[model samples]
Target: MNTSTPSRHRRATRHIRAVIQILSTAMLGILLLLNITPLLAYAQSETDVTELGVVKLANALEEGKITSVEAVQEYLDRIKAYDKKIGDKPGLNAIVTLNQHALEEAAELDKERASGHIRGPLHGIPVLVKDNINTADMPTSQGNQALATYQPKQDATAVQRLKYAGAIVLGKTNMAEFAMFWDTVSSVNGRTYNPYDPTKNINGSSGGTGAAIAASLAAIGLGTESCGSITDVSSFTNLVGFRPTVGLGSMAGVDYNPLGDAIGPLALSVEDAAMLLDVLAGTDPKDPWTSEADSHKSDSYLASLKGSTLKGARIGYVIAPFGGYDYSPGPESDGIFSTTEDAISVLEAQGATVVKIPLNRSWWNKYAPQNASFWATTGHENFFVRTEATWPKGLAELTEPKDAINFGDIVKGSPKMEKTAVEWVMGDDKQPRDEAGFTAAVNARHTFAQGVDELFTSYKLDALAYPTVAAPPAKVHENPGELLDSEQFGTHCGWANFTGRPVVSVPVGFADHFPVGLSMLGSQFGDVKLLGFAYNLEQAAPHRKTPELTPSLLHTAGSTGTTASSDPSTGSDEASSGNAPFTSSSGMSPSAVALSLAAVLAAAIVLISLFVRRRKK
Candidate 1:
């Protein structure tokens, strides 16, 4: 009876199989459409840009994975996506201006590549410069309205070197007005927001460059730091900011708030920062301060990035620099207590041995007043004229820390203004300092550097680790008040500037969900080694993470009544699951699929055995 019904069974089975094939193909088509659309979009989206250093880019170029024009276009598209204004709305606004000639320059680079000529690591890399640095091509506005339209006649020494190294200038970045304060704001340009969280400030005169690099807007960018300008900004924005020992690079054409300032590089990765620093570091006759620096320039910094360099590195931790200072009774000398322990904790946990060391804050307080007196006493008359009377008609009152764009205007009026900005802090008629504050600060700087140097000698330290500040970045409004009055964290950063030490700031982690920086200060001219050490520590700790701007999906997973249990042996437990059998949010039972697969295989095996027995009979 079974043999006679075989033909009928085969006909019914064929009809069912045809239905299944039709449904399966339809489902496959829908799945393919769903997958292909996003992939195509991802390929088309300009956001696929890699935020790599120049060295990495060069490697990719040589490997034929990326074209020079494509790399430049990726960065330009990112800048266009993140830097423009839609309306009364807001975005990152990290870039102050985009290089108009970037495409043309990139075309030239591609042409050079076609001719079998490679400039170097930076041959096709795109970089951004702080607005204070003269690019000659882009307008150099020092984040002030006065210089919004001012353009330099030539590149800064730093910029010239970058171009010679084959790097492309992507644009000019915004900064604090005249690089005057820790908080970043500019009358000429709006504020720069943190890339991880747009609601938060990026932190500083170099904030724009930090945010840009963090968001993958450029390969690298130049940032000038007078005090905590670079470090604090780097910390909050999760980027590498290097403040090279003063005069390690020429600052002749770089705009300055006052006379003395250090221009450096900021990048997404420490390697990229090293690449830029290597190319730009050297002496220049135009800048007198360059003579004071140690002539230990290297052809490339990447050659020295040995991860094993930190194996036995001793890291000094500064709990408080102004903890016990008793000199000035002003607000600038006030103490700030922190909710979290200093950033040294993060550094210590990451493997480097950390030692707590207290600094004499009193010496710095005394030095501050003495230094102010010296500035006032030496230039009182000139300061009064600049502040009390306007030099040119229609010009605003000349003040200390004038805009770099209007610097020329001030210079045109009087030679003194050309030499120094008109600041009332120092006047020729002021009373002489009871104590030599400037000398004391200078001496204290040497003392601080020496104390750490000796500590390094004693411990065979690679670098000293310290908190960029006692706390996370202060509010933008609070920056001015703290700078003018008292800030406990001021000396934490200023000491590096005082000693002309190479300090690299890495985003240690978040305190209260806000970014915090741990700085690595190395011996004089130890920039490359210090950067390598910081990079390794960063890899070990991995403190920085993208901010959660919206409600986490895990919260939604927890709200559901289902409780998925994790397999303890595999460490696969759902963090939100209670210890019980849990239903999946996706309506599929996990055990059902396994049972169905077993049944299908069993049926096939039984049919095959029957067929074999029939043949044998």
Candidate 2:
């Protein structure tokens, strides 16, 4: 039950560093005489930490090159270095609250690793969760100032799955207020700037995860996508994002509109995403939507990655401006489109049959209006009225859980609410309701999903590919008073969301230094197959580059970090992606903690020197 704050952790690390400095200074003369620069061999580990992803970090832990404690502390240091305002510039502000007991949890995981009981692929990996997702130890503020101190009774279903898998819940990140905004601007934590370009806004509700993971603040993070929240920001920030079928992942304990909300991973690569999905994709008794999960989900999404290649695969590529909707402004559209075209050519070069799937302009024109009706007109009120509803009750001023959540009461409870969010609770209710229109919209959606399915069937396609986000990152000032980015020319998320299908986004390339992601969608319950295609694309065309804004910091296991990729993607089409070969059966008898300390002892002295330099600055 004992926990420690960041300051306390810092004091402890400082004490360790002080002892290291004294020992190192005394041994310096002897070490220098012998030219014992053991730490310098991997002195670049701290700087190269940006190069390591979730899978690589996991591999390091399994290999005894690092421990969960070192990895956790490394990310914490990165957060301290870059998350808040530092020097003359604005920081990412991605992290909303640090989990005080993260180090404690990580140390325990290390003990388990030492005891030879590995939980799963995520053992010891650090993750940043979106603030809207409930964590028992942290407040689930939903990015509203009024609910800033609102603590949930337990962790969300997805969070429980993560902890059970041995992942560290490092902290909570700021998110779009109520997961409703296009830009992640919260009244409690303000806006999260894109690390790709701090002046621009990465499209959100999942912006904090986008920025944090993009900047290497954590090994990976979780983000909820109602529509394009997960993929859009991931596209903007150059990270891989997956939005599984609506019911594939649980939404219980997460304050979301059940109509289209789903929880998924924002990670460095498709391999890592699939690994996380293995843990998250399952049926939850608390959520009725997940009833199909146990049936639909594969035994291991990672298994799908084995021997999966795009060669001889039928991939339907969207030749854009296809539906008379271009994804960017003027020349920028052509530039981004050109970038995507060049990347898509890799699909063919890798022996995949790339079939052009041009969407009809009329289909899109009618679909837009129908989509609006489906999202805006139905299910919201009733969904909130269900037993899962907790809005009004979460507000500090409104303690009665029995009270119905109303806009007027919500606005009254949080007087200093973000302006854009206030419209949700402060809007006039005098507008007429259209039951007939909603019914028609629902009918249209079914027909649309069926038609799209026929297209896949007719084409014999495994997945359909398109530009994830139509445009590059938008300037923070570009969309004033708007919930959706006004500058976006194209986005295909609604196609997957309304159809209840699986979709994923991976970095294709960069345009003028801004990241662009390619989206591939599959039929409902075909998440495993979809991931295989993405894995092929990821391995063949790895475009992920570390953000320049936030680099690295002094780390614990600097000497033990891997230079070559431990990525499972290195395997051939028929072989498993070499996923750290973890098992519950006993192997090494030596204590993992002892080995981790011994492995990094030489490096800790180097880290101390770096730490002192950082402090002086």
Candidate 3:
């Protein structure tokens, strides 16, 4: 963690520049303007079972058409055929550990259906989960070596709910290391690329789950967020990611959660996300906090999935909040934001009134810094640090422990985990604060929380909406120097986390070939209403397009013809988007440390040369 090693690799910067030039020319927005059919048209063109989500598949299965195993197998085959093609270049590595017993479990479900015992809504559906959630049948490694073989004695409460609903656990998805970073670079599993562009970041720490659902690796996946981990990455990966109100879903059996991290659903369709949320939302005696949950804890969340649910809702938009960090808003980010802005327009068209709101930067700056401390004290501690202090000697080496964790870094070797250690103590370097800073930050967080409460009360608003990120996905290893522009967006989206309010990130549009998300921020515990608005907007925008893995015109053509055309972008999808435009005025200006030093050296060189010439004379 040398804080001063040039923002990125020199080679990565060159590649990013080249890709940006190509993308700027062949932007997705241009294609949308030309009236090219969206990627979703593929489902309309064919009766592909893969195109159908869990609920539809369940109906088909119940009607004696498609067997449960058949549906699960189709998703597995999809993972095999299109995993790498859609841009997660190495193909889709969405799945970390495939349940060897998936086929067997599906067989059992089919038999149960034959026995006339229908489980429920998620019955017979194959669902993927973020690695941090525990499952009795499989190892739940929170993407760490330390718990490589760790297997929970029981399924996490959420997983249990899925099982009760008759969903088959397909596998454990990949994630960021200990869910520490937003990039899916795990010490154990390498990286999880964006399903749309493998070369770019899928958006972590819940990236694998987002990519899995977007790519249809599984009908739905569960992703957890401490801050923007779920919502931000889901926005980038073109999926629906929900962060429920605190203590809504039972955290029992989840590997992490010293902080109040809530696990929610990521899916291709918002309805599917809602279904999963319904199954998972309930009071659990094991978690004392659940006792304080809103009285609506037991409400049927799925009942709010009506298409007309958004009518008459009041929505606020944050247009300028995140624009500050975007140096090069990729085609995906740009397209998605425009699409979302247009979506808000459409919502207005559909009778929902929209209002513009200027964000409070002072409030954001005050409380936002505590997110690292919150995450570290909560989820990070329960999952990793606590394990170190409690686990038996050589726990990972025990008899085929289900979770595929590699703990050598934590236990056996005194590895140079100083970087990881530092993160545990502080947070990400880009946003760091000290003890006093954190204390002041905690107070600031309360003030900001109060502001949000006031906004909710004053406006009596249903929800606030904004683009998930300043730009779309960037290639992995892109020069970090360029991402300064959209930092404010990250800051803005992140404020909700500090406030402990529920936020839903739905894929509404694409920008610069990357996926941009529209977020719905609601009154505390207004998860259902936020989701309702999203569902309505989703229909209006209906722009979910599958990325064409290969560079083919047909891919860019109507979905029925071929995959989408490939957009030129360099680096990994998980890396930072190329250099964001720097603003000279406004905000904490980032001094160009490297460039400034280079200038200083050049001046000294000229002075020395002049002195040398004088001496020679």
The best candidate by lDDT is 2
How does residue 460 of candidate 2 score in lDDT? 97
Error of 1 at 514 (Å): 2.0
- Please tell me which model should have the higher TM-score, number 1 or number 3: 3
Using lDDT as the yardstick, the better of models 1 and 2 is 2
RMSD of each: 13.8, 12.0, 21.1
Model 3, span 1-617: residue lDDT tens: 66443444444555555555555445444444432222222222223454466666667777877676766666665665555443333665667788888878988998988998888888789999888888877777777655556667767888988999999999998887667665775655666767566666666788778777776667788888876778888787767778888777787767554444778888777787788888888788766656666475636777777733667788877753322323344454445556677667878987888888765555445434334243233223324433322243455443333242223334332232235533452342222224555465456556667767766677777887777765545467653112211232342455466677888877665555567778888877778877888888777666455544411111112232211222223222321111112212332112222233334545655565555455445
The alpha-carbon deviation from the true structure for residue 401 of candidate 3, after best TM-score superposition, in angstroms, is 22
Off by over 4 Å in 3: 1-47, 82-89, 292-294, 320-337, 360-444, 478-491, 550-617
Runs in model 1 deviating more than 4 A are 1-47, 85-89, 257-260, 292-294, 321-351, 360-461, 476-491, 544-617
How close is every model to the real structure, measured as TM-score?
A: 0.67, 0.78, 0.71
lDDT of candidates 1 onward, in order: 0.60, 0.72, 0.63
Candidate 2 weakest lDDT stretch, 10 residues:
574-583
Error of 2 at 480 (Å): 9.3
